[model samples]
Target: MDIKDKLAVDVLVVGSGIAGLKVSIELAKEGKSVLMSTKTQLCSGSSFYPLKASLGTQVTKNDEDKDLFLQDIEDVSHNMHDKDMAKIYIEEIKDRVDEFEEIGIQPYKLSDNRKACFANHGRTIYMLRDWNKIRENVTGILENYSNVTVMERSVVISLIKRNDKIIGAFLLDKNKELILIQCKAVVLASGGFGNIYKHNLNPNDVDGSGHILALEAGASLLNLEFIQFIPGFTTPKYKTLFGEHTLNYCEDFVDDSGNSILDEILPEGLSKEECLEVRSTHGPFTNSLVSKYFDIAMMKQIMKTRSEEGFELIYNKALYENESDFYTIYLNWLTERGINLLTDQVKIAPFAHASNGGVQVDHFGKTNVAGLYAVGELAGGIEGANRLGGNSTGACMVFGKRAAKDCLAYINENSFIEIDSQEELNKLNESMKHFSVHVDHSLTPNEVIDSIRDIMWFNGNVIRDEQNLLSAIEKIEELRKSFNISQFVDNVKDRKSAFKARNFIMLSKILLQAMLERKESRGAHYREDYPSEDERFNKRLFISLNDHELKLEFK
Candidate 1:
């Protein structure tokens, strides 16, 4: 690698997702030099995927609604949310949402808005109801700016740190060549770790690289155990997210038998329809918002039909007969697969959807480490244990722009100090070379991913017990020891795939470890061995690495 490959920028935004692009656009419009890089093409991440180009936004009715919204976030998080961060989110969300409208997005209001604290409570709006529109509109805005450089198919390998400040990063470009980016600040807007699971709704490239980047950099991540699993597809032959907006017309959760299983399991106080409606609003089962009975019923049905992968999610006849066209996305998704939502039953199982915890950061998306900011799903504290349906999108926009503002302020206050990179660059080169010298097994990337996915699916999924989790930990640890980068770096796709594979193992270990550490069942993460939610375990558990050793503490 030649020194000419080294490039300097005012800010390096890692990820092409909405959050990263949002931040890059913010800075670039202000005439700041910004380099936005993604492992794949623009709009190829979760932002443009199967979720039908949807993003959540919130518009405040008044100051009182903002307070109610803040309370709702804390309530959804099971009281484990960072209150100070919640305050900032509530304060900035309206302004952040207004920016989207300024960019030409028109959000439709729900016909029957829920209560002020619930999903789509009149305050909520969509960044773009259709996903492709987001790609077109958001990317178009970036194209208009002269100060931004969009680099596609660029894989970031490591962050460059010196004396407690992040100066730059090392990346493997699309050509399999190393490029070191020198920047005053770095914003990790990379999404979550959903792709690591067997059944997921994330892009192929979102294999928890952001989490790994933070972990190896010695930053703390909190509440990583709470992975939100929604009822996603199992019968389409290809996996995609089961749109939760259609849950409004759900007829029944019928078993192989002709009975509605939900009717039998729902507790006395909550009716089956009400419980399902609550879940339909958010898609994930959260004890703080709804009762544990919903998740218990769903997971029990999954276990009952475990041999067949999962059970059916049948739609009501009224759904098809209904005059409204609200379900265009669901109808089209079903009809395209030759399955009718009105007549056919779709197999529904818990799919790895959104991650609640990510790099622990303050209100400004700055991680505990200086100059390293995380936006969107890459940052924790906004969503807490279980995020509401529309909040994640709002969080990303609010924090993404906040990170940009803070990044600019930090750059103005401080100048980049010259540091020696020769030694660190050599070590990186040696590590890459070390893989080639030690290649032994004819190991493939898919095999590594498949093995880890199964472990997470069976052991660390919706309902997990102590024995299964412990066994998963052991097996994953063994797999971790056996995996080598050299086995899959022969090709560019495989090299990026290899990077994703490595992050999957490392992040799954952290997830399972966190799950094992939490004995009580709370929100998305459940411990069947200790089913009760304990008040003593209410605070968030954060983890950091010290000299490669795990350190756990509470915030």
Candidate 2:
């Protein structure tokens, strides 16, 4: 086993999204040596993906409105949130927003000063002034820190733990060589596993490798079942996010068979107009509202047809006046992209947009493992079953800063443990050989990924039941058995894909297991067998790896 290089830093940030960059900037300001490892380039991941023209970061209008904001979060999450973490997020979000504004990520003020998101009340949604500018600003800020080392195209394959504490990590660099990064503290700000699904709005690099890294390093992941599924375009272009605001003007939806999609699937007593109107208020699919039926119908039609091309939406101009600034901006952005809501035929289906569950962390982003932390979409607990639209970015900012400050203090007192490269290299060699030794087929890594995505999008997707989940778990088991990692890891790119496939398969299995365990439908997680929320399952299900087996505990 040939190791490329060995380096040490005070802190290692395993992502380059808002959270990773935020924490890096904070640590660099304190003169700490921070290594920011990104799978791709800087500002890449769901945080900087240009699917939306701008992202809305939430803040309260006044101290009086804070209680209402908290209530909204609890209500939308259906009492499935961390009460303490939620309160802390609300208390610190305003400061995070102000901090970003100073760094040129200005927020666009609404005329009303407050607007509702996902059924929340008095929520002042500060749309980031411009998505591109925000990316440039963050990238520039991170670059200015001489103490920060930005290692692009470096994927963290595994964390190096000594005595149950994170002392270092093994990074697979762009050259297919291994680099050992020893650090006093590690921040797992890596984004969520949206790309594991067939259709997702996240970047290709947004796989759940970070979660697997943490799990292997003896960290627990919370609420692995609560994933946010939303509508995304399937035609005209793939991977484009379907704006929920368009639902307000949705007159009808027709499948590829030229039949009304909502005609049969709409629940009794819920009219098409009423359903679409209710669904238009939020971005992600939720069982807490009547709009859930809309997502259900879309998913059902897509699954039944098994079509890559989704259903078409008939737009009604009379349904909306487009008076709101949010609507105007979104509509104009669509027009600029050659998509006319009224004239164009828009095809959409339920796409895996984001994961509301991830590595379980406290308010300061500390995981169960010592010297390891998580933030952004990678960390869970602050936003429970379902996350509010803008709160994702807010969590990144608040928790990212908090984790950095806390970990900086840790680094000041603690010293890095001895990292043995020879032992780690021996393990890596054995794993690589084991990966190739068992394989009999020559399936490309892309094909393996496609197979996993198909299984997840079908069985473990929005609509789940006992039978389908079992089928999915079984299929994933078969796929893992058939796919050989080393048969395809001949080059740098191929090696990366192999790692992604392995992580995706493992994470998908865990997610399906979580979905199967949580029988009751709540927020983002829905089960056909158990159609209602259950009080017995209100607590978060934390999943961790122990003795090479997965363990689940409720807290």
Candidate 3:
């Protein structure tokens, strides 16, 4: 009941990644009091991974490049993206990139030769090699804005909704006390639920709580079925994502038994060079590629190993002479593990890299729920099925700013109305009372999280079938029965795990149910039962809660 940082602000941004940070800085610059809260450390989300810099976007030198870029996004989106949003994103984002460049945070072209940058697609992407420096630059500017109050370890427990509008939120401070956040608007940039999978690059804190909060507040999520599965090293030290270009050096994607998985699936027309170019452009394995069959084989192999290494990415060192930047990272990763990049074979598997769909938002990051906005990986529809390489970071900058500007406009026109604090507090208190009820003594959040990972990896991973997805749903439902939030609240030691577990469970059910609804393969959500993409199922799937019942629809 000890309220901390309970002061009012024009906007409350729930996250600390590029999206959240961008919103806070933008609004604060305009002299609006902005509260940016994170569940963990300031720079600990997917954006601030300690090991390596996440892939970023390329700069478009001219209008023609921009046009081609738009087309590329549409093509990769499987014609399912919001066409207007794509245009708005490309045109509006250029200015943001220019702003970054002016501020000394810049990106380098992925390849040396500009003309034949990519044979499969005629384009070059820019990646920020000095990610830490750029991160420091952004965070540094944010400090100059005294209007931005950043709170770490402050998680948004739930939204305070009244009369179909989001008026405030219940925040859990570091002291584990309830803080009623009364604000005009809330921008959710809480990142993705990659951690929901057994193998992922997401930190444990990045569990899908944002999605859960949106659902509880009457927001609908679109395209929840499209989770991008990219090949990354999952052993020795996990979640080391190979640069897409670096993976091009991989002459073959082989298995431990010396079987060339690529050989088994490589199309008759696609040469080894063409195969590399296509794979490099599209980071995740796609059925669109002639070599997509390799991904299906890779998924099977990874599952077959279950708890061990299975695939070897073979590369010819001679071919790597021209590759410098990306090759260095790949080489360093191997060298650190005492394996020679030139000699030792690397075993990699598909990782839940990014979520293509999230809380359905408009061009301005406005969700279905009024006064609630979502940005970054938390907002969906930007990337339809599989996202283009390095677009995640740039899109965050673009939409985060848009959300801030729109939220500010909304707040200026609409005054912050006072509400009954006692009523909201009582609602939360009632939910907390259920924590200790009907709890099994042996059941813990860790146990539940592991079960979720196992089920999702096996049934809801790179490839899926009806039987496994339905089984996953059943298993998740049964796990929910064994443990409840009251159990975690009663056990203070596992409070964090319990809350995070609830979010993961919510995300798992949403994803699986969406998968069940979509019978055909499209982009990343692949169904083995329906092996081919169907025009009938070309629409996006939407998930939302109606009277606590999960409802799914597609159009």
**TM-scores for all predictions:** 0.89, 0.95, 0.91
Best model per lDDT: 2
Tens digit of lDDT per residue, candidate 1, span 1-555? 433377788888989776887788788877789988888887657765656434545555578687767667777788767788778877887778767643435566554534432343555454456656656676667668878888898888888888888888888887767678888888898898888888887777777898888887768899888888877767744465676656677767766675776887876788767877776666675655554565567677766566535567777676766555556656775677676765655767777878888899888888888788999887888777777667676777788888889988987777775646687787555655423334356446677789998888878888888888899989977776667776566555677777666777677788888898888988887887887799888889898877556777765
Q: Could you tell me how far off, in angstroms, the CA of residue 444 lies in candidate 3 after the best superposition?
A: 1.2
Deviating ranges (above 4 Å) for candidate 2: 101-104, 319-321, 430-437, 487-493
TM-score of 3: 0.91
Sliding window of 10 residues with minimal summed lDDT for model 1: 111-120
Scored against the true structure, residue 408 in model 3 reaches a CA lDDT of 87
TM-score of 1: 0.89
Please list the C-alpha lDDT of all candidates, in the order they appear. 0.74, 0.82, 0.75
Model 2 clash pairs are: none
What ranking of all candidate models by TM-score puts the best one first? 2, 3, 1
In terms of TM-score, which candidate is strongest?
A: 2
lDDT of 2 at 27: 86
Please write out the lDDT profile of model 3 over residues 60-99, one tens digit for every residue. Answer: 5467777777777877789767788778777876677655
Of 1 and 2, the candidate ranking higher by lDDT: 2
